[model samples]
Target: MAQSVHFSTPVDTVVSRMRALDTALPERDGLAVFNRVYLTVTEEFDRQLDAGLFPDRRAAISLDVRFAERYLTVAEDGRAPACWRPLLQFRRHPGVRPLQFALSGINAHIGHDLALALVDTCRTLGCEPADLEDEFDRVGDLLVSLEERVREELMPGPDLFQIADPLTHLLGSWSLERAREATWAAARALWALRGLPDLAEEFADRLDSAVGLAGRMLLTPLPI
Candidate 1:
């Protein structure tokens, strides 16, 4: 028999663990780490939904909303978590495709929030929003291209290994190698605005530490 797990506990534990790890990071880099962790958690939640681990799509989205709420609540108080409440309610509606769309919207919301946070962090170091926006756009383009490849080649056929190959070889490699690319860009933008030499380094260190912690959590076995 398969064992069932409560939705909130493991997710909360992971967030709490992440919080401890966040302490070692610089503030700017910490935000990037938080963004990565949020993305990873949301992606895993979606994967569970696809695998039928939840009773239905509704259940999956409900669980996701709960997880997101817990995550945001822990990270920045209850403010941002309130935004995800609508997503939870949307799950109760009928229709698989609409539910999927809503989930996509939720992901977009989270992404935008991260991007804006990056901009704000840069601004605090005296960087211009336009410069940060440019970097964000560049990163978004790269992500879109990678996503297209994953959708076209990896998801369409029975040869799962082939799809996994590129995702593993290309996207995975890029993510690992350039994990701090966003922080670098943010730092550079800040430098351009204020000539802050230490700002970028500080942010980069924090991001690296956070990512390391998140990687460990991902590898850890959950009770589920």
Candidate 2:
């Protein structure tokens, strides 16, 4: 089962909950594939924290836990945002490859959930988005490196690398760089609109819808 455990707000507990999900899910399950990648990334983030990479350790911990909670919420209850719906909906489809699943989940988490997480962390820590920029950049750097590794490890080989290949275009169509840029912008906008709860929620809903469209494209069925 891909169902997750009871997760607490603490960082270690977050990691442990993800680990439990990883252990319970089947190896080839799409949810498991993404969960495994997320587990590795979260563990790496935890290590960097322990090593004191962030200048404001407290801020970093707050952001990390809040960011993780966005995904864990869905993992625990299937109460996913629009951006996450595509991956959850198509996860079991035979035509959706492992790499597709991985990327779709990444697209949803990075593009949509991240912005909300930033806002959430700021609210919890009584800080502004500007205050958390350094920690955000550090985590972004880690994500960039890990994304490259994920592509290398999960991407299909030369046999699937032709101009005519749908996967080629699909892979090229989305860029992590662009996504991060947009996420940061969204976070700032969200922060600015915090005073107007209605507008802020509308903005978030639109962002979620936009990211969901991208995720749906990423999960487009491929030939089995």
Runs with alpha carbons beyond 4 Å of true place in candidate 2:
1-9, 160-164
Clashing pairs in 1: 25-206
- Tens digits of per-residue lDDT for model 1 on 65-154? 443444455345524333333333332333212212222332433332343355444445454545444434433444455444433532
Model 1 root mean square deviation, Cα atoms:
17.8
Candidate that scores best on TM-score: 2
- List TM-scores for all candidates, in order: 0.30, 0.92
TM-score of 2: 0.92
RMSD in Å for all candidates: 17.8, 5.8
- Which lDDT tens digits does candidate 2 get at residues 1-224? 66534333378888999999998888888888899889888888887776667789889888888888899998878899999899889878987878788888888888998899999999988999999999888888888888889888887788776522777678789888899999999999999999999999999999999999999998888776
CA lDDT, every model vs. true structure: 0.40, 0.86
Reference-based lDDT, residue 181, model 2: 93
